[model samples]
Target: MTMINEPAHTLPVLGEYDVAVAGGGPAGFAAAISAAREGAKTVIIEQTGMIGGIATAGLMSHWAGSAASSVLQELYKRSTVPDIVEKFPWQGTINPEKLKFVMFEMLHEANVHVLLYTFVSGAVKEGTTLKGLIIENKSGRQAVLAKTVIDATGDGDAAARAGAEFVKGREGDGKMQPVTIMFKVAGVDYSRAVFPGGFEANLDVPKGKIQDLSRQALPFPAGHTLLYPSSLPGIVTVNMTNFIGIDGTNADDLAKAEYECRKQMDPIVKFLRDTVPGFEQCFIISTASLLGVRETRHFVGEYTLNEDDILASRVFDDWVVLRAKFNFDIHNIDGPGLDKNGAQKHFPNVDGYSIPYRSLLPKTVDGLILAGRCISGTHKAHSNYRVMPICAAMGEAAGIAASIAAKEKIAPRKVGVKKIQDVLIARGVKP
Candidate 1:
């Protein structure tokens, strides 16, 4: 490693806000909108020009979680993100382009400030308290002061930069989930394709030479691919390529993944066209602007979620997210294969499980709230909560908690969990 001295320089304060959110993904969008609606002077910063991180930017247009659950059920009731397209009658697929605008309009209606094309490179901290965020953009380096900060960055960027305790990947080899470059293909024949009832289907024809990625009872099933119907007829979004052995948090590894995953596009299209029934005339259309990096930094919080909690359909008294029905899904950390246990399709309980508020509070940091996949949870649990629908619920809770903390002039961790719970219940969640 090499070290160099950089001269001290003053940074302009961008603006002071009651609540500031980093990463304008699903979690950030919900967090900012909820906070602003609660009368907090909130501002959300996103690294890209567009909001909706994985859903829009990453081109992963599929929505997870059932309509029988909390905020998601309300969204379903209100038709918030319209079922513009459906692979099946109830697959929950969406049009990403439309979703980006929908999220933006919601934030605008809430009067929340949005700063696009900005990166949160660092943070301002006093003792163990996160005071503000250090951001960089075309304008130059600056600061955004805030009373309550929410780390909806998905990668725990703000919390990690503020010296919050965190861990990356799973134990042992410390390998995270594989990254994919989602691409769309056209000229598919609906009648000819296997057309699995759900949005996701693993076509046996596209299976390359299979290996025992997981040598357990599964023996690693064929087809490391997942295809979902696009909003348009004869078009499908393919999440097939898996660039394993790359770290999402490392710049060099991410760069390599972007290059490698893009390279998988043409060959995969050819494979589908050459063998699959519906994709015989299909051709590659577009690759995602961003790689779909599933797992990254998981921040240590007051209580960690685990696989058993999800399996038992557990609920907590201090629960924030209710009836989170997404399965305990995880990709193979060291191989280009799907975790057979991914998306527990046949869970008995329709009531689902709850995500505890304690999991959103970073154990070692004050004035900070966690949301999205990076919240305190095991790798498997993180996979379940990482989906867009569930992430939005967690973000809403974080937003409500943050706004209350800002109004009361208290740290986010010090806010009464019951108050947050009551707000969620009033909003139609039974927590």
Candidate 2:
């Protein structure tokens, strides 16, 4: 890997904006659109060509939550494409390409300036506030001056670099959840795949079966295989197995995991072809360009939502978004064999809870807001809220709040939560 250290220099006032959102994933997309739609000069800087982050790049296969109230709903309303119908209880799938176009059109219609292939390397800080960002691109390093910035990098890169406090992996121990190499398989027989007790049904092959399969040299996870329909018919996305104990931030660790996982996929594919029905010609379409990192640095924000709060369906006066499920299928790749042993420890929850905007505001950082999985929350709570839908919801709130703060020429932390809530409510975003 070629790592270049380009010195940060002031670029000719590359225009100003009310808000500058970094990381054009679900959160950044929502933030940029929300800010621009709310009549703020917004600019989105994405490191990649695409707008949808995990949804497009990671090929996440499906959105793991409902698109009802909260920031999630606001996104659908703000989009330029067709509105999403409430047709889900959980584990909802979306067309990545359609969603991408929708996001692109939304930003365009909102008049938000988008800068793709721009990597935000550092922040240009003034005391506690970041006046702009130092971006590295094909043209070299330059500055993007803005009033407020949102750290939707998912890894909390902005907050961390700005000297914010954060916790990575599990508390105390450095163990983290496994990172899945998500891939899509085409030429699948959807009818046969979704059949009762079919390939998808036998996903959670029992230990007896696992042992039997292991002896028979079949390709499968130790106990279960999670697969879902892709946006295209005759295609299915597979998030099965895991690259255990791989640290996403560590290049070497990720490299090894990728190699091992690719090697391991061969047998699994062979097994599916021979043992499973309607998968004889199934093949790996594409692996995620980047690793699907589940957990990383969780920024310590103004509020730390806990698992109990989610279970109790706790609603806060400062709530910015709502969740529909607790951490149901939580997985950890490291520590005490959690992935192998903790599968049965499901949190009791028939409903989800509200997430406060405070969770997005890092306690130790000023003029910087975080969205996505990096927001403040307990481990268990992160499991539920870390999904894409909630992250996008939080992104909307953060964008609106930042814009409000910018317009008032005040610090983000000084912005009133009530004002933010008012704007969200007016926009039909359940706050």
CA-lDDT, candidates in order: 0.79, 0.71
Question: After aligning candidate 1 to the native by TM-score, how far in Å is the CA of 95 from where it should be?
Answer: 0.4
lDDT per residue for candidate 1 within 393-429, as digits (tens), equals: 8999999999999889999878999998888777777
> Which predicted model would earn the best TM-score?
1
Model 2 spans with C-alpha error above 4 angstroms: 1-13, 67-71, 74-91, 195-223, 335-347
True-structure RMSD, every candidate: 3.8, 4.3
lDDT of 2 at 128: 78
- Enumerate residue pairs that collide in model 1: none
Going through the candidates in order, what is the number of backbone clashes in each?
0, 2
Show where candidate 1 strays beyond 4 Å.
67-88, 196-223, 340-343, 346-350
Model 1 local distance difference test score: 0.79
In angstroms, how far off is 232's CA in candidate 1? 1.0
